[model samples]
Target: MTLEATDVSHGYGNETVFDGVSLSVSTGEVVAIIGPSGVGKSTLLRLLALFDAPDRGTISYDGEDVWRQPEGRRLEHRRRIGMVFQDASLFDASVRRNAAYGLRVRQSWPERIRHGFAQLVGEQNGTGDAVEALETVGLADKVDQDADSLSGGEAQRVAFARALAYDPEILLLDEPTSDLDPRNTAVIEDAVLQARDRGIGVVVATHDMHQARRVADRTAVLLGDEILEVDRTERVFDDPRDDRTRQFIDGELIY
Candidate 1:
């Protein structure tokens, strides 16, 4: 599967955040969008996730224009994508329940009814997937704990597990580890690699250049209201085609 944003432009009111930004990510690839803060990296991820329509360009899933599709088709596309935002935004529930929330909501009504019945009959609630995901994020021991009681990093890991549990074809991350400590950040980065190994296309929006160099197969620079460069990770860092990209990478340019 592939997600592509072509010449996409987005804005609020009369102020344009970005313009003509084109990017693509394919299954089994990790693409990182790197830029200084407030450069619309998060907004670009939102567009790729199909959460919002581009004002003057196209967002496509496997070559079909996402916003031009019917609502049902658009929804189907959304189901195949998972996104983790900067804020963890976990529910007031157990860690297990929060991790399994996506799969639960995607179930058919009859499936949900049967699941509830099985739970009442002393059967497992089919949360093996959730458990596995929590284990991936090193949270298996916290499965029964209240989500509200977790530290910030733990809650963010729970959010990541929630997205991973349902097996999305495309995963979108918006500064997922910006607030995390080094240990938690490493955990999240490893989970991202595991997702890529499982043939899931991943787009990570991050301002952390070192993290991008460590995890991304390809890196795109978003600056000055456009994607100035997208290339292999090494090339983007060592031999950037754009002077602006070099400036940003060298800590000389910042908005």
Candidate 2:
């Protein structure tokens, strides 16, 4: 599934954050929307996630305009495009239940239900195929812990695991590692790459340029409330094409 935002103008009341902002993300690719705090990076992600509709613009999935679709269609669209918030909040339930939250079924046999996560990550001991998922993000040991009991980083991993568990085609990340230490950040970074390997297109809104350069294939630099530059990670870091983008990287207020 591909996400395309075209001429997307959005804001609340008199303040317009973005205007004529457009970008595209393809499967197996990771696009990082980078900018300073409170610059509408998260707002743009919300628009792409279909959580909010733009005041004047359109969002499309594979060329089909989503804003034009009905509410039911929008729900289905969201199901296919799973979202991972900064603080990956798992329910107050068990780890197994939390991971299997995406796989919940009303008619599924109760006995076979818990087996969903087990099936995804085989051979219990938290050492099965699901182990691979956890191991990918260095969270293999906390598989049995309750969601609320986990640390910030661990909860985020569980959230990623849950998203993978859902097997969505598109992954939307909003400041996914704003709280992690360097060690934990690397682990989650690997997990993001794993998602790309699985052919899931990822759009991440982040403040960490280092992480963006490390994980993103393409970087979309948002400035002046619009995408100022969209290019390869290396090129973007080495040379930003926009004045506002350069100012952002240098930590200088554009005012």
- Top model by TM-score, which number? 1
Query: What is candidate 1's lDDT per residue for 1-255, written digit by digit as tens?
Result: 899999999998999999999999999999999998899999999999898999999999999999999999999999999999999999998898899888998899999899879867967687999999999999999999999999999999999999999999999999999999999999999999999999999999999999999999999999989999999999999999999999999999856
- Please write out the lDDT profile of model 2 over residues 172-240, one tens digit for every residue: 899988998877777778889999999999998999988898899999998777788899988888888
What is the C-alpha RMSD, rounded to one decimal, of candidate 1? 1.3
| Residue pairs that clash (backbone atoms under 3 angstroms), model 1 | none
Rate residue 207 of model 2 by lDDT. 90
Q: Candidate 2: deviation at residue 120, Å? A: 21
- Which stretch of 10 consecutive residues in model 1 shows the poorest summed lDDT? 116-125
lDDT of each: 0.94, 0.82
